[model samples]
Target: MKLVSLITAFSLISGLVEAGNERKFTTIQPDLTEIRKAQATAQPYEFKEEYVPGKVFDRFYNIWLENTDYDKAAGEPHMKDLRKKGITLTNYWAVTHPSQPNYLASVAGDYFGLDHDEFVRMPANVTTLANLLDAKGISWGEYQEHSPYPGFQGFNFSNQETYANDYVRKHNPLVLMDVITSDETQLSKIKNFTDFEHDLEAKKLPQWSFITPNMTNDGHDSTIKVAGTWSKNFLEPLLKNDYFTEKTLVVLTFDENETYEEPNRVLAILLGDIPEDLKGTEDDTFYDHYSLISTVQENWDLPKLGRNDCGANVFKIIADKTGYENIKVDMDGVYNNKSVEGWFSDKHIPLPPPHCCE
Candidate 1:
């Protein structure tokens, strides 16, 4: 269900901090005050110009805004899947369009201001989520769905079936392999999702696990239904397992919104052993990929990675672990079906078809 609360006042500034030799800055914390001001200035549930076009897409945006229900959208069911065995990010989001940019954003927060995917070698100064986590002695892995090794080119990114497991990892081959392969523990963490099944069953997983499901299963290569099904099949089983829940956080998020017109659009859900006060309740707080990076760093008491260190904080999706009321429905108020009707029609918003679908 959707919960709407009017937010109020604050000073949302943007800039950098230079203390001694270290550079510091704030993440993209939503200006609740700004949101409240905008809400007060505009009518409730009205579509903002940024999220809608003239007439067609505006209708969709208006409908989505009015509905305001997070549960209405299609997503995985059965929290007992294999992959979601711990903390979940109900309001997680990726930074930009296309998988590469979002992936980089998730790891480095800001994509280094690159507009397109270019396989150039990243500089030593370019810090990643992995780097930050490592600096703090917290182990982490990218866990590309099909990769066997951990390095700059370990993540598979090909359309072919066989090549998927062995393709290069980044848009730019210029990435430093040392940064990727230096950590033995972190490198060992990278594995195929299928490889995690044995670990899940054996109750042998690392302290902090960061997984990147295959393109097809994580809403990148196939229908949303397919993605949901795969998520439920793999992640749900683990969340329901007691062995994985003691002190873990699980996050499943979309890399970016389906359309550019809906610029600040992405899906993130959190699940796991969070404080009782922050479980099960849905939060509408504005957030993005960088926020997640910040959250992780904050959780582990590590220094912030690159731009995301102070960009945004993940919205508190569930605040109490009492478990939700299990309210599943489509946008039309239909029970069972998860897909929203007319969510992306020509009548709803003005945007090109989804990149993968097209």
Candidate 2:
């Protein structure tokens, strides 16, 4: 009876109860028609070119480290290894005040005036990179360490005795987006780190992956050295594995800087299957979190989001792939004037039009 009860509970949780004695799995693949309907409602934007020949990458992986300054990361041992094996962006800066905005900007092109890390929910109609990737049939998923389960909606999960945050919702940006959380099928893709190892071993990695280490490993409640060592241990083997490296690109970056007074510069490295000639080189082009969005779109021949992505610089490696010339942007002209001042305040206003090519 206990066994039967456990099975019944799982069936209810999965919405796949057995009919009579035979069990049948329900089809929960993403609804293409619904995706198209939602995408049609988004504001249209044009790509710079009508067509691009081939995609630069077969897979994309992003690993976001926590609040780390550019100077500190330069001295870390793992970062040194990355510098030797990959290209580093010397002039990369975080877009806004805090962690949440930077994460949101990476996927949504605009932070939408977010100045704080409060628990705010995005409206369902707002289009995100997930929508764009799904529209093109490109697979995407987020792997968050210490998360309770796929589609867990809690704000924070902590170990009982220590009271230290293991998984914080603020760090996992996809759960805040309604488009991903509204559907069980989409939400299931936002899984814990254990599933990541399983999927990797099974060769079921998605085309685009957003990975966030737990608070300790991500340096939220720890030091950059801890995060760096954790990253080295976790990523070194994957970097050496041909199964994971072939035609794959992995970006390692921090969420924001520690001090608000200094310019929001963070360390960013492009590793994994980097072009032979460009390896161990540095690109000083000015870029922020939005560049991640632009680079992905450029690589996959997808349309721009028309937010900061329109004005953002694509990664030089991707530019080399698409056969396009790289252009530098005047960072001084860009401003963050859309949010009210306060750590917990929620008064967010719309940003002015982007100054593309200015």
Candidate 3:
């Protein structure tokens, strides 16, 4: 009996030793020499030619409306007017389900795993398109309607009696990024819509500007008709102005769709100084939120963030002039996930509260 027990113990010890050796061999780290060699072999993309005057517009303005599906916007009267007057991008899609992630992805190359519209702050190290614009000495600003101050960091502001949403932090992506909020100078650039008018009057508008309407006007707490009417009224005067019309590109788009089950297709319009031949035409090229960042990079010959922006398609006009090539990607595979429920469950974070003002 003692001899049998000794032999069994020896067999068990040998098995354990073999398992340990297997793990050690499989988990070996790559050496510095191998890393250097891999980096050396990587090829960087080069543009065919330097940026030309007509390749990209010098000024860019983006207006992001709230949750409205493509159907609703297509049926709206004012939306049709804008479509008739400007170039329409019929194949544009939102990057994700919620509003915040789409907005973040528009400025930053990626959404950074944000699945909720909570008042969450991003790490300061995260780079944004504002950083890219700043690096090239281009001016940028965010004009949020009904915001209390230039750099207010609150979650939401509402009217006391009506309880209507005046401004919500989640709608403004610049406030969530620490890179902008940390610097006083940069923070001051994020001003209220009133300041936008003042800047326009003084001809002091930034080269790149993002505009967000209040909850009601943006169709979040109201109907598509309301949002369309407000946009038409606000844009008619600006489109007629010579200062705003010359060498300027204005993009009007939505944050996301109303239904998570449907494809995240949204209405997008391009106006203001578009090439004469392209006006009143439709472009069916596929585009996502990262395309906004990629378009800017192509316009100014700026460096990419090496994230999703690396794979995004450039705007059609810019592509025509610069001979830009888009990275091939499987769109259906990329946007398969619909709701944020799985992400919220995995992170153990509470779901976003319903909009009380709505």
Q: Best lDDT goes to which candidate?
A: 3
Query: What is the alpha-carbon lDDT for the whole of candidate 2?
Result: 0.73
Sort by lDDT, top down from the best: 3, 2, 1
- What TM-scores do the predictions have? 0.57, 0.79, 0.79
Report clashes for each candidate as comma-separated counts.
Answer: 54, 0, 0
Ranking 2 against 3 by lDDT, winner? 3
Off by over 4 Å in 3: 1-55, 327-358
Q: Model 2, which residues run further than 4 Å from truth?
A: 1-54, 331-358
lDDT of 3: 0.74
lDDT per residue as tens, model 1, 1-358: 2211100110011012121322122222224354345334331111111211111111100000001123323243533232233333344344444445555555655443333433433444455666665565544434445533333232234434544322335422223234554554434445544545655565555444456555555555555666666667665565567776545556665555554444334445565554566554455454565665655554445565434345355334321222212222223321211111111111222211212200
Ranking by TM-score: 2, 3, 1
lDDT of 2 at 332: 64
Give lDDT for model 1.
0.41
lDDT of 3 by residue, 1-358 (tens): 3423543464354333322121111121234464345435432111122223434698888999988888889779999998877888887889786888888878876665466676666667777899988887778888999866677667777764687887888899888788888987788888888778877886777888899999999999999999999999999899999987888888999999887777888889999987677778998788877888889888988877766677578878778788987544445534423532222223333222222211
Q: How well does candidate 1 score on lDDT at residue 253?
A: 57
lDDT of 1 at 305: 45
Give the Å shift of residue 167 in candidate 2.
0.6
